[model samples]
Target: MEAILRIYTHYFIYYDIEMTQYANEIKISADNPKIGHVHKPNSEATLMGVNVNINSDGLRDKEYPVERGQKYRIIFLGDSITFGWGVEKEDTFETLLEVKLNEIKPTEVLNFGTGNYNSEQEVNLFFKKGQKYKPAHIVLFYFINDAEITPQKSKWEFLSHSRVITFFWSRIQGLMANLSESKSFKSYYSGLYSDDQQGWINTKKALTQMAQYSRANQIRFDVILLPELHNLNDYPLKAEHAKIITFLNENNINGIDLVPFFSSVEDPQELWVAADDAHPNKKAHQMIADFSFDFITRGIKWEKN
Candidate 1:
């Protein structure tokens, strides 16, 4: 009976720990009017066994003050890919890039990446919150889905603090989205390649504004085009990619396309977080960091004194 009691005690302890961990997963607040959502500042959460922390500025990193003559600040702006979803902060490409750039010169890469952020929201975030940082360079990690408009906040958004509810809700939403044969999904996935949709137009406008802002501030601006995993193999969105490239060329913005490099891989599937998630894994992040390091040091002329 003593052995049975010991086993029960151990099981209870393990169960409690598991519950606590899951409970910490939900750390986002939906009260932001500018962006649909923002990370809860100074909060810690765990997702896919990876720990994430949001600083006082609601960024993914720890508190970092922006000051001139100390370190060159580079702000990375984008969606979940740049946010390092499904990976720890240290495993993120932004952090890796920071480390690599610091080797050449003192630098700080501020991660302003937030999940579910579209180009419009990202641009808004930069103008409202990020501009105060006064970064020397801005890197926008452009994902195809970034063209989509931000979803309106629902009443259920208030329950986002509950990890259990959020997790199950997310799963249900994913399932519904997959099963959806709606025109919106079809237009987004298939029609976007050929048609010049409003989303694409808005995305271009946002990018242009961001570029213009950078030019006005004398900050170097670069766009890193991140491709979807499936699109990498067959290149379903060639037309869309070309349009973006043309836009960048016209705006005189530096665009780094990662599709060719990612597609050149023997197996692009290996770079994904999981079969379902489709977010880039650690290998992909490492490759991006390496490529970006090369681009920053060799491709662009930096006035690093």
Candidate 2:
């Protein structure tokens, strides 16, 4: 009986660990002429043991009808980071920011974040769908990789549905990514990070348009720059951050850089979901919410109409 109980305990622990590492199975529907592809509406999935719900608008939030003048709405735009990848809907920084802001004033945050979205896709999504929400403010969360073009869905994406397979597959992928000198990997990285690349040019144009739209509509636009987890300690992306800051300045867009704060942390890895997965964990989201809360209340001019 003792041996049997010990075996059962081991199995349970293994199962729990496996589930925790399981990546979310995002159900992608038909390609959108505007944003390429979007998650199926009203879909449900679990990522890293956190449940996710995609509302009718293909956003990771509760289904709330857009009724202008009822509450002050702030639209959030970005890729998987703003979408709360590897975390539950409520645990997202946008959701947390909404909750925190509402405690001070009546406000609603509309999250328009989606996985694999670059700056161009995010801007397109806003004009195509998010404008109906009647947002007074727009917060664009800029991740370092937002300048890169979205990659094609892997043939093995379907296999990710199995938690056990995903766990092992992710490990294998991580191992491969670390061997950066491989021919295929070098080309991929070069395309993404090259300074004179078209991807960067496209990103700048989209952001500039977004800024112009905000100015014309009298909507407050603020950009929150997020850092890649691996570089937080070494701070290797200063040049990239500077380029983004220069673009924001030229466009007259308000911006905040979270790199300095994250760099000060003793163990940046503690803020990440996993060593393999660089997405910010729940604690990091809370930090972001707190930081943005202070920035909004103090740095920005937001008055209730």
lDDT for each candidate structure: 0.74, 0.75
- Give the Cα-based TM-score of candidate 2 against the true structure: 0.81
Residue lDDT tens for model 1, 1-305: 43553354344423222233433343354555557667777877655556777888888887887565577788899988899977778888999988878776788888999877888788888887798888888989888787776666667644644445544665677688777755334346555434467766777888899998889989989888887776566777766677777889998999878777767776677888766566898988988887777665555444544
The stretch of ten residues in a row with the least summed lDDT in candidate 1 is: 13-22
Query: Which ranges of candidate 1 are over 4 A from the true structure?
Result: 1-32, 158-187, 190-196, 298-305
Clashing pairs in 1: none
Evaluated at residue 187, the lDDT of candidate 2 is 50
- For 1-305, candidate 2 gives per-residue lDDT tens digits of 43553355344433333333223445464365447767677877655556777788887887778777757788999988898877766778998999878876788888888877898889988998888887888989998878786455567766654545544665676678676545343355345656688778888888899989999998888899987777566776777787789878877889988888887777778888766466888999998888878766664545543
